[model samples]
Target: MAEQWWRRPVLVDAALAVAVAAAVAIAIQVAGEPIERQADFLAYALGGLMGAVLLLRRRWPLAVLFATVAILLTYYSLDYPGLAPAVPLSAALFSAAVAGRFRWAILVAAAVVVGGLVARVIEFDMATLPVASAVITDAALLVSIVLLGETLRSRRERVEAEADRRVADERLRIAREMHDGLGQTIAAVNVQAGLADDVLDKNPVRAREALQVIRQSTKEALQELKTMLTVLREGSETRQPGIDQLDELLDVARKAGLRVTSMTSGEPRPMSAEVDRTVYRIVQEAVTNTIRHANATTVTVELCYAPDSLIIEVTDNGTNTQQGNTSGFGLTGMAERVSALDGRLAADFLPDGGFRVRAELRT
Candidate 1:
């Protein structure tokens, strides 16, 4: 991904400084004013100094603007020429606007506008239509520069907000993944360890199978931990679960004594990686909840893919209630994932002495 525009503050400000200087030099030359006091050179030196100040505009925007305007206004007060006002003043206004201090920027802008108009009135022998048009043009230029800066400021803020939101979402996702994957795997290991201990002498083979399950669960848990760490370091993961993992998921539940079954309908078409992973997570979490809390013997995972949307349902005939699962993001994380994709999640308890977690997902 490309870096944010504001990340390299020096480079951005420097480029802007150079552009402003070039444009101002061109404008001053276009006016064709005589160099009586070497006013053109003075405009160059003074405007160069002003543009140099723009390099630090973001740090002290109002100060930079005030200083630039003060210097320009002083030049106008000396009655040297009219070439020093528009370019430097417009640059200052833009810098202030970009800084997002609208109140301060506007205050400075108002002062600069009034100063520029007064300079125009004093320079002219008479306030004719041409002179009035010049003043209006300067005012328009002032508004336009500040408007551009304000627009950019708003855009930068929006981009930053979106970036912050994405970061928060990703952190939540990693947390939820660890909770679901590691939490369930560890729970399964605990259950199997207990089972192995219970039947160690009478049922040696069964105990060995339980031990095997525990070993596998720990390995899978390690893999899940690795995935989360990879995401933290690289901001991405490759081992995302998909529809293909449903059978293995159900098998794991069966091994954990849940007697889970899975069913799918409609032609399974291609889905985005994110959607696939999220679907698998929802299923995993649902099954894990059933194993840990449902106290039921059977859990069912069903998937129905339509032309437009996909529906997932995980139900258990366990009498274990799920109304007050506020310990962690049990269903809350699933809801966030669903909401991000503009999907719907209904994870309430069923009335028929069972619990159900259902989600309808969209691309």
Candidate 2:
């Protein structure tokens, strides 16, 4: 229900300019001419109208300048000094400069001053010294206004751009942390839960072992989450995971009932953090999808590392029933995550009545 600042009226400026213009025109008419004359009456009215237009100088600066200039030129040519037209032009020049168009403001100011000076000199045969001095003063004032405006505009734009970059960088950092910390913790939990389920009916000792692993995994996950929150609040942390942890990740998935086969054909090398994480997440999500969606008795995950690319494939022999799929945000989120790393993810029903998901990330 709050009104926007931009929509609010800036009436004070317009009102002040109009009042000044009206006073000037009234004073001139009272001293030098009869107020009853049509010319004097029209001059004062036009001057007040042109001055009132200054209120819109910030929003429609160029338009305001041209309109004010045209009105003033017409009134001055018609022999009426009622509208002190120079004020609107000065406001517009300053606004334009602040909006980061200094060159344009300077060009307009130059044209106006030069033309006004030439016209006045040729028409009135004015002395060169005074006319040149006034023109130079006006030109200098316009230049100063424009320079000030440009400086402010540049500073504000830089601040906004820096803020945007920082926000984006923070989001990316958070995303990587969540992917590694939460994903690994969840994988360990899944492994222990599976082990517990398998031993619940037969061996009490094995079941307790699984439960202990689950407890440890949960504790680690909590610590990671807490660390993440702390980093979010305080903006510093020394603990971070990298591609070196991929083996432990695979071990966790293996415990959870996925047969993961990882091989590096190329020389072990470093990759960008984004690409490394993308590879890890793609594999993780693919394996998770196999467990959740494939009712197969066996799932196979393969990771092939080449010189310039990492290929990952998750295939399951379980033929999950082709029932109505009412929920699948994980796959959608996975696709988005992969695309953000400039990779492609493909999921489909295998011709052999199974499901497979594949992704390839360029290092």
Candidate 3:
């Protein structure tokens, strides 16, 4: 208990102030001063009392300032050199300023300087220099300290905001990938299963084939989902989704219902995972939109690979309900995803009643 109590700043400051006061008292005694003088004893007692009260500066800054001011006034009035308690006074001022009450600190600082000046002028002493210097130095130091604290706080806030933005961006990208990849595959499976169910009694062999395709499509989707999710949930930040299985993805769409015709141009080559994933995603979304929104039922997906870029296009005959409450969020999400990858995406409604989506990803 004793060790912990002494470790506290308030307790340590109080102890030091008391020690200085005692030293001052001893000096006065050694100067052959009359100890029996009532005024002299009273001054020494007031110094010790004021120093003790200063221990509570952090807990009660205003009270500490009030007590220190009173002590200074009493000492100056009585001309008691042994009662000079500048240490406690400075500590009280610093504590108030650090407590984030700058206006109050300024008011107290002004009052101290003015009162000290008035007292010194009355006493006709050279002590005014020390008092004035102490007041100015303490105020300046306190102001700088507070300003530094605020600056660091602002910097921390900015760093936190940047971190939040990065996280949000990553999450949005993940959602877009999941939607473009898993969403399309799942939708195809649903369509194939529904068709098989309707045709099972009339055409057993065709229905069995459709069911097989559905099973294979869903299994592939599961594998792709696992791979993408693993990259997202763990490993290095450089990990990305790529299109290593484009043929299988397209086959699933073909089996669903839409007569999808796909053609690849230029020399096929390996590309960056991010770019590959983006190509697959754009095609997947385009195909899904064709299935869900088109009426004429014929869809074509073309991938024109050039030396520097890959061009993707999906066009379908429009016959579905175009004016219905459709979730256009998928289109909006696709645009955001493509832009992040430095790609361009465009969607158009044909005057002849068809829809088309074109995307170009630069290498």
Candidate 4:
């Protein structure tokens, strides 16, 4: 898609150039002293040139500032007009400051003010031009213009930084969603595929059941993926799996060959969407890890609700070969999710012979 015509940089610069040129030319004609007929055209030419130099300000701000200052100084040196020093130089100073050249803009403004005041003292009598008053007024006006430009630059930078932060946050949310949603489904599918391969000829009925589980797991995974994509593409909220879906989640694990059971001991109450999603992800990750790494036949998921907190624990009676390697992405993501809600997570080996994951989330 094309950028709006007014928003295009080239078009904006062209408009600014025309405005500056007109302002400079009008300032000269309105305030300039009478000069020779031919010299008036030269004066106007110099003013237009000052404005024209601004067209390149974005690319070479310092150069443009210097060029505009040189043109203004030349116009005044020829005794063309007694225009205000801040008027013609304001645009250039602003451009330089906005381009992050604040020091250069300040130095140029100071030099112009000092040089112009000294020139006026030398050319006109001190009585004719109130030298001190003129110097004070001109210096204040130029400083204000530079300050304005610097303020705009700072504001623009802050806005850009906030935008970048939001983009990063959105990306991280999407990643966590993908990991939680698809990781469990893929692990179940892997287990079912292995079972089907092992019993393909020897136990045709078992193999068929395993294949059916694989088909269902894949279908669920595809549906979850499509839902996530829809949320990303349309910027709409989709129903995320929560504690209410635990039954279906456990059933899937059972179909994949793991005898999974869940028990809730707390008085179930409504939770915020974020907390609900986090709780589901915690259990989902725990189960997937049990299926993949903890070679266990039976798994138990427990949910205990207290007055101010919700506690979840998943334990499996399996030979967890990867017990020491609990720092995988799944656990790390789970820990982050728990930590985000000011909660705590513990993943350690049980005393007897299994692995356990426990999380406590504050309501």
TM-scores for all candidates: the values are 0.79, 0.55, 0.64, 0.92
Clashing pairs in 2: 98-149, 296-318
Which portions of model 4 show Cα errors greater than 4 Å?
Answer: 1-5, 34-39, 127-129, 323-328
If both were scored by lDDT, which would come out higher, candidate 1 or candidate 3? 1
- For candidate 1, give the lDDT of residue 2: 97
- Model 2 Cα lDDT, one tens digit per residue, 1-363: 987654555755655566656665665565444433345567777766666777776777777667767876777677654334456577667777776667878888888888879976997688999898878887788777778888888998999999999999778657756765576567557766887898899998988888877787687678879978886887664433445766776665565556666655546677776676666666666665555556555666666777777777777775776411415445665677778778888888878777777887778
Task: Go through the candidates in order and give the clash count of each.
Answer: 0, 2, 1, 0
Tell me the tens digit of each residue's lDDT in model 4 across 1-363: 988979888888788888878877777667744562333788888877877887898999999999888887787667677554465589889889999999999998899788867776886667644888888887888888889999999999999999999999898888888988888889999998998999999999999998888998999999989989988888737677788988887877787688888888969899888889889999988898888888899999999999999999999998966853855578888889999999999998988999999999999
lDDT of 4: 0.85
**lDDT: which is higher, 2 or 4?**
4
1-363 per-residue lDDT for model 1 (tens digits): 999876788988898788777766665566555653445577677657767888888899888888887777655555454564667778788888988877776777666667656655775565677667876776778788888999999999999999999988777777887887777787688789999999999999999999999998888778778877876787565567788877876777888888777889998898998899889889988887877777788888999998888999999888776532846777887888898899999877777877888899996
Candidate 1: where is the Cα deviation over 4 Å? 1-8, 11-52, 197-207, 226-239, 264-275, 304-311, 322-326, 340-343, 348-352, 361-363
Give the Å shift of residue 46 in candidate 2.
Answer: 24
Full-model lDDT for every candidate: 0.79, 0.69, 0.70, 0.85
lDDT of model 1, residue 240: 71
Candidate 3 per-residue lDDT over residues 78-126, each given as its tens digit: 6555333445555566666655555676676666666656655665465
Candidate 3 error regions (>4 Å): 1-133, 236-239, 264-273, 305-310, 321-325
Indicate the residue-level lDDT of 128 in model 2: 92
